[model samples]
Target: MTTAARYATFGVREAHGVSPAYERLALAVAQDDEVLALLEALPPAKRQPNLLFSVVRLLGGPVEEPAAFHDYVVANWPAIEPEMRTRWTQTNEPGRCAVLLPVLAALPQPLALLEVGASAGLCLYPDRYAYRYGEHLLGAGEPVLDCVATGVPLPDRRPEVVWRAGLDLNPLDVTDPADVAWLDALIWPEHTHRRARLRAAAAMVAADPPLLVRGDVVDDLPALAAQAPADATLVVFHSSVLYLVPEPRRDAFAELVRGLPGHWVANETPEVLGCDGLPEPPSEAQHNVLALDGKPLAWTRGHGQALSWFG
Candidate 1:
């Protein structure tokens, strides 16, 4: 069957209680001649698949990023096999970890950051001016924040970040308006506010594009992690990017980071299990904020984006 068809079937079956308002995917694979042709193109391993497709099926609503990939499947089903296309669930929600805000407060001065899998880099440049923290406001019209967080002490004039960069398998170069527009369009329309924030950030980056690289995390992790300044609290962070990696590969990458010297904070899913037959799906998007010694400080998500305060 076509990849979309397979995923559609899986999603339809899972909708019972997984997501109340999930997308309703179709299972017209048998009827579509294109599906058979697509299935024929699959390697023996994928064609003999049991539940990989079933795990990521679509239901109830439109598949996220339909604009970037839907038509590609419809027009080229024979060329696109089930294994190549995956159903992705976009996660752009801010965190609710209590330790995070307090960590931000402890910065000694302005700072730098590096975000891996920074799809469009909006959250990477989180300090572009004003933000509301319940009744308190931070950054007061600053052109993005240069925050250098610590375990204690919320002070102004933190460390000066010599740089801020990001790495992604598919990096978004906002200097090109077309690319920026495409990234903006990729965002689901339901998230109007997020779309707006992404647009504003895109505009800011368009003027001064952030340093980005398109590469594999396995190969790029070491170099990127090593780039952190010694005096600076080097933070190698990512959001919702770990699910795409294999367990062994993910473990290897995390081990490499832990071995590095600096603050290694990775915001990944906490889900260490639940892939069923598929081996890549993570357990949960745990908000991992670690100290320079490679220690996890908290875990959470919400208004403050705090998960837990181990401190």
Candidate 2:
């Protein structure tokens, strides 16, 4: 695809669903020749325009106007170069815990939770953060998260996570200043609430961090799942992670989950599992379709900000 076309497609397929500010920025980037050239200069693997955009904003670049944002990108190309090469757009969003709540609520307590592609393992602490879904209010503490729910009933109480561990290609350490800063950089400029929540979640994990193992998800998942307590209900879960897996390996991951002893919860794009009854995602923006044991549950916004439950 042409540069403009690729970026335009990104704007529609990814950014449009994220937020209005992001959609506008992506569309503007799609049209600007200079910016496109700058982005195109990067290696194909490093050509994530959204990450570039988020990095610029994280560095205090102009975000109020598209023209100024474009100028900032051009001017800061030198500084941004290193980040583009080194960083993957790994956003460890804790807000996704809201979507996981309803599913967790339905499961038996004293669960052994294992997350694949668990960036920083923030979602592993679903019980830590407060949640509000319609009239239902759950959890209490400094970092309260809210989600709009429809059709599905809210989880009555947080699942008792007897054992918790995460698997990722590169697991982040909450105690590390640099790792924490990079996570902060990954957040969009407009979402100050999310940034604050990230910091709070990071602090919570720092007090007692979850076990995060670095390895390929498909190869390492079995061993990691084996480590869970045998008596507890083993729940293997992932959100928005499988899309990163290559097409061939995605099926392998699914088969691995199917072979496992317990239930599986996935919040990913519609086509990732190809499961029946999964709802069609919106044409304009990406949505994380939630499923439990291959049954469609709900369709949610990327960050778990909104949900259309199919319960």
Rate residue 10 of model 2 by lDDT: 73
Error of 1 at 149 (Å): 17
Candidate 1 to truth, TM: 0.60
What stretches of model 2 exceed 4 Å from their correct place?
A: 1-3, 13-18, 41-45, 275-285
Tens-place lDDT digits, model 1, residues 179-262: 555554434334466556555566666666667777777788678766766666666666556766768977787777777655
Pairs that collide, model 2: none
RMSD of each: 8.4, 2.3
What C-alpha lDDT values do all the predictions have? 0.47, 0.83
Clashes of 1: 44
The candidate 2 region of ten consecutive residues with least summed lDDT is: 275-284
